[model samples]
Target: MKKTSLGIFTVASLAIACQSGNQAGYDASGLDSTALASITEEAYKSYVMKLSSDEFLGRKPFTKGDTLTVNYIQEQFKQLGLSPGNGDSYFQEVPLVEIDTKPVSPTLTFTGANGSLTVKHLDDFVVSSKRLQNDIKINQSELVFVGFGIVAPEFNWNDYANIDVKGKTVVAMVSDPGRYDKSLFKADTMTYYGRWDYKYEEAARQGAAGILLIHETGAASYGWNVVRTGWAGPQLAMVSDDKGASKTEFEGWISQETATKLLNLAGLPKDIQEQAKKTGFKPVPMPVTTTFALKNEFRESKTNNVIAKIEGSKRPDEVIIYTAHWDHLGIGEPVNGDSIYNGAIDNASGVAALFELAKAFKAAKVKPERTIVFIALTSEEEGLLGSEYYTQHPIYPLKKTVANLNIDAFSPLGATKDVSVVGFGQTEIEDYVIKSAAKFNRTVKGERNPTTGGFYRSDHFNFVKNGVPGLFMGSGSDFMEQDSTVINKRKAALGGRYHTVRDEVTEDWSFDGILADIKLFFDIGYTMSMEKSFPNFKPASEFKELGDKRLAK
Candidate 1:
């Protein structure tokens, strides 16, 4: 027998208590308060510990770790007595291609009037080929400086205007023009146009043979070392039906220093970035050409997105999804004698929260009116691939999904007086977050740095892109009973470990904050589950029209 807030109760007794409401009490939203006890720190810690342990090998997809990770999640769901979410199965197969692209030479050389300058691999530049082919080559493709390489007509911005990049290698700056100029685009806040992935997509759309984004620490929100570590190994992509023919032959990054050398070699001004930031900046065709080739070793493999659900008793067609990616960096380049990028805080924490949420929902005395779907997604580290695939081929109709609540990385710092909502004020779904936070005397706030484009970096953005309102919450900054120095040091320490082999669980971690967040998440999801109204995207939101179209369908 399990001991809940209502004292001793077997599984049978708990179900009866749910129905009779004798020992268990209900909140203002009619959610069973007793169920909240199920989201304990012990359970969360256990899941995080087990999942992030060395045996999991960082939980990367297409590895033995992937098989073990998915099996653990599925077995947990089964033990919780939840039905499979994907109609008779707990797993949704996501096909992916692992492409290991290696350059033919140790250095990529640029030939110009000034002479030839070579950039070393993994030091000055890093490149990858998304195309599903054994061999790829770019033979002295003309080099053109294409500013930001964005094409957003709505924002009255077109970097590609009056320029033809056909068969040429376009050298663009990472991030958008708005990053430098507050008057342009979204100002300090980064839109999708600012993402490197978007830059590559735009370049491919313009028929560019290759695209190299100049990496600036401030604009890219990360150092060159981070980029080198991420792109040095095999890259994963969705196994496209067209074999990625629509993409550019190669996409890469060149360090800011290397970019400067190339610009100086071409006799271009060092103030090129300043000129590009201004409106109506045109592309400059540099008198330089480079030959690049990649020998790609690729293999097609499948991974699973572990999904399970608690079906609604009344309106079963409608759903409220809770998602978190289960995959991480896997075994990567050795750092400090450690090879596994465990990703304990990056996502294992989120998956643990997912499990706790499922358990909490099951503990409730009353069943939700809307189906509650728990998806332990995969490959979020490699460009939010799992969620993107799910949105593209939804098991439930897009029109029927109420909203997406996503958890990516949870803070290990202690409890705070507020909760951070990424991409704040985009939808009415935030109202639920606000309401839930108020119960615990915590205020709602936006992320500390909106310019990093944190919202677009997560899996929830995929749901928002597909017309479903989505919400992503983060642990608040204002730690209770902790001084600013201690907090800053703690935060900085964790920041240093992010995405590295050192992302393992530390002994000083506190789950008090996480437990509080879990309750708030449960409250929001529970409220949405019982509500008949759908949350709509705000008019200023880029996804507004998509939301309207979804509901119209």
Candidate 2:
């Protein structure tokens, strides 16, 4: 059972504050206003329960669940009087290819001066390929331990210095060297370089045949099971123009235990990772060679992005997008005899919020000057594929799009005194968030765990990459309850259920927090839509240049 916080402010106060907030640009006495006011706890609860129900079959893309999920969202949009976000249809077809890879017997074998060692799949290591090939084989590729596998000229760090890894396999650590040496990167905060995506990208750029990241739970901020499950299922990717030719043949992870044993076999120091964290560290050539054969069964399918729009009264072409991924792990390995991975809090809540927000807008007496687009994206759990595709083939030009506000897994642990803004300080949108949140007697805080790279993990990152400001906010732990212990325990419990089958809707969930967050987001987006100018990335942000270039175009 979940614990409820008995706070200084009662639930009645929270409801009154949220409903009585200044509806500045909004029509004060319209159906929309009434709808917004009627976003009651019971209504929100019903939406979540139905969306996350087992009948949806976990809402995985390319399955019956996808059909039901998209149909339901479309029906809701129609009921809300929202027109198709696309030209004439509520659906945007995203072409995708699913690769179901099963490693051959004796999948990974390492041979070194210490003799041969075999690692079991999903036990000692988890491997997957981005390349679109039926059969992939690495024949005794030389293994070289290349620190963090980072090549950042700005940081003056090159792990591949004085080494040629072309046609060879590179074994690298999960995060950047700065994870250990605070002064190296962004101190303890993770940069894009620390992301596994960057490691694989850097390896592919250097012509490496394969890349293996050594997993450390603390450094990666997730357990090995996450890695195993995420990569084990039918991996989906946007059907690349080059068919993933630019990607490395293999990208995988090895458990810390497996890594230590591999290091011993290679006659390398077990403390090599420690040594690599220092300044001016060079690549280490391990005496190990690896061989692996992977077979992939491929299927091509198309998924639909449920997009609904509220066109602006004036600048109809100008758009503000609200995004959330509708896809989850699907029916996967059962946990506790339950095979369905009902992504209740993982996203059903966000989609439910999407519906509620749309209703609120539709019922408004007056619409904003800019278009508001609500997009229920697909294949986010697969790698933000839906949003990525939208950016590539945007319904509206990126230059005309003001900003993106994304809602993913919201906290159900009751109302809080603050809201955590991921990627805080990167854009001016945060200022709007602060102003809107303050009306509720709440504050805005930067991400509490920056090391997890939470900012880039969600659908908003795709927008940020394309030079549009995006905001991904979550519930803050600073609850109304004086004691922090209650909130901390709640957070810990949520973390355990994340990405697991146990992430189902529970009766104990308090919609007060979710309702507050949704209202804040609605306010921010409404404010942006009413404004005359677009929100730009801060000058210090790496994405600022891209935004400027896109806007100029």
Candidate 3:
């Protein structure tokens, strides 16, 4: 009943077409081109609209929304006849601890030679404890400005080189030194050292009691609202043996205005922050101490990762994975009279594409030679938790996983002439992407903004960390009906709506772009699934050694 370029062909008609020396028709393996073309815009839009509806409550983890989302995806998988990806189960339990902390009245107090200064919460600063404890406090913790708080030997940079930050609170800059000097580290592109996650990890390693990063828009690539939303409600993290005690007692951010006022109070020039950008800049011990305490409320909970598989007909043990996070910011601080962060484009779109891809593979007359596993992950907004857990406790052997193809936050601007491959040159999977896109007269291009550190920001990074080659692609800007200016405007508009209530499904949404992108993924996965060769990380990749090690094992 479906129309395609190759025309509507049933099984019998496809067989007849194949008999006429038509290589594009049904193959001996029973794969019909018509079925591949059956992936339609209507099917894709239906899934997105349903998943991003208000009834789902934004799909945040450990909420009613989470329950509704997991159940829906599981039912879809069951209906599609996909076997449980986990051992006899479609769900993989991820143990998590949720911490809800509220600052005591008079949240932050700083005392030094200039006198005492009091800062309010939410407006000037926000703080919380990751440690699982009834009471947490930093009493007169000596405050020190530790530049970017980076200590990368590769770049010959260390902000805490001569100073001992033990038992002190380090007020650090948001990004790395390279942000100022392009020659420092990876030029303008942000390395692992530039991420807030890396900042917290480094601070913990230095035995700091607390760390507050000065929020800056350009460097952080987001506004304060994102930070506030992340700090609000119940914060989820994988339960650790130490209950996160090894990390700082409290980690947070202060507005640039607040940081300036605090610096002035510490008898340091407001403009002294620029000094920290230089390589030889030493940690400046602010002539002040900060005091704060948090009364904590904690709950231990679990979330499920929905995984389904279509086993290979030939190499059953080998796998090609497709992943997308289903979780988004749930009911939080309201914006424009809307509390739900629908995340329609942020992730609901990606999940819908996952379902469509699964449907396509299932509908194919011939099964892939290597297994295909589709995973709808949870808590990606929190920090790639589901994928990290799965990697640690893998359902299939890591060495046998030929490649990971991740879809996240797709564009709705219709089909384009190119696709953006995040971390394009890091692995050999780019070859497959290029080949697949070329089939439709589309080209493969690298991410337009590598400085955002986008390669490390998504779920695929987890797979790459475990030595499996992973590819994450998004729709490009060269729309068929629109020029670069219109495409750029659409992308800019989407950027403004990211992580906000305005991210809900809109009337003008188009699925032509998504349909093309999904078909590209199908082609890439199919090629990987049937090939005898395994893709490896390129020589320049930091993950190359890990991939080689895993393969060797």
Best by TM-score: 1
For 1-553, candidate 3 gives per-residue lDDT tens digits of: 1123113223333443345324545544333566577787887888898999999999999899999999999998998789999989999999888888888774578898979878778877887778999898778899999988999987898988888888999999887777788878877667778888889889999999999999988888888887777775678888999988898999889988888888999988666889888778888999899877888898899998999999999999999999999999999888778899999998999999888888888877667899999999999998899999999999999989999899999888768888899876799898777655655567677888777788889999999999999998988867786567766666666657778898877765767888889888887897678778999999978789998998898
Candidate 2 has which clashing residue pairs, if any? 32-363, 32-364
lDDT of each: 0.87, 0.84, 0.84
Per-residue alpha-carbon lDDT of model 1 for 170-271, expressed as tens digits? Answer: 999877766678898988788999999999999999999999999998888888888998898899899888999999999999999999999888888889
Q: What ranking of all candidate models by TM-score puts the best one first?
A: 1, 2, 3
| lDDT at position 436, candidate 2 | 65
Error of 3 at 365 (Å): 4.1
lDDT of 2 by residue, 410-459 (tens): 99888988899997768878767765666566777788878778888899
TM-score head-to-head 1 vs 2, winner: 1
Q: What TM-score does structure 3 among the candidates reach?
A: 0.92
Clashes of 2: 2
Query: Positional deviation of 266 in candidate 2, in angstroms?
Result: 1.2
Candidate topping lDDT: 1
Q: Give the TM-score of candidate 1.
A: 0.94
The lDDT, on a scale of 0 to 1, for candidate 2 is 0.84
